[model samples]
Target: MIETSTSICEVIAKLRIAREAPYYGREYAFGELWNALDRLDDREADDESR
Candidate 1:
C-alpha cells in the first residue's frame, strides 16, 4: 500500500501510475480510487466531529 503523511489522492495517483493500473475492482479503478478519496473525506469529517 502507498503511505503518505500528506495527500492521499496524489499517493493513489502515483500508485495507479506505478501499477499502470486502469481499473481496480469490479467496475473500474477510477471507482475504487473515488472510494478511496471518499474515505479520506469521511476521515476528515470524523476528525471534525471529535
Candidate 2:
C-alpha cells in the first residue's frame, strides 16, 4: 500500500510539473488526487499499527 501511494504521489508530482498538465485549469482534480494518496498512506499506517 505504501508503494502504491508513493507511486501515485510520484505521478502526481510529475503532473504538477508537466508542460501539458491540466492541473492549473482543473485544480480540484489535483487536490482530489493528493487527498486520495494521503488517505491511502494514512490507511496503510493504521494497518501497520494494527
Candidate 3:
C-alpha cells in the first residue's frame, strides 16, 4: 500500500505544517501516524509470510 500511505503521508505532512490545523496542532499526532503506518506494514508483511 505504498501508494495509499504516500498519499496519506503527503496530506498529513501538509496538515502538520499549518499552524491553524486543529487536529494536527498536536505534533505528536504526526509521529503517531507514522508509527501506525509501520504497524500496518508489519502486519501486512506477516500476512504475506503466512
Model 2: worst 10 consecutive residues (lDDT sum): 14-23
Model 1 poorest 10 in a row by lDDT? 1-10
Q: For candidate 2, write residues 1-50 as lDDT tens digits.
A: 65666767765764565535574755665665667667667777787897
In candidate 3 the C-alpha lDDT for residue 34 amounts to 65
Best by lDDT: 2
TM-score of model 2 vs. true structure: 0.50
Model 3, 1-50: lDDT tens digits are 67557656755665555535467455765665666567667766776887
Ranking by TM-score: 1, 2, 3
By descending lDDT, how would the candidates be arranged? 2, 3, 1
Q: Give the lDDT of residue 6 in candidate 1.
A: 47
Name the candidate that leads on TM-score.
1
Q: Tens-digit lDDT track for model 1 on 1-50?
A: 22323448654775575466644543565565666677777767776787
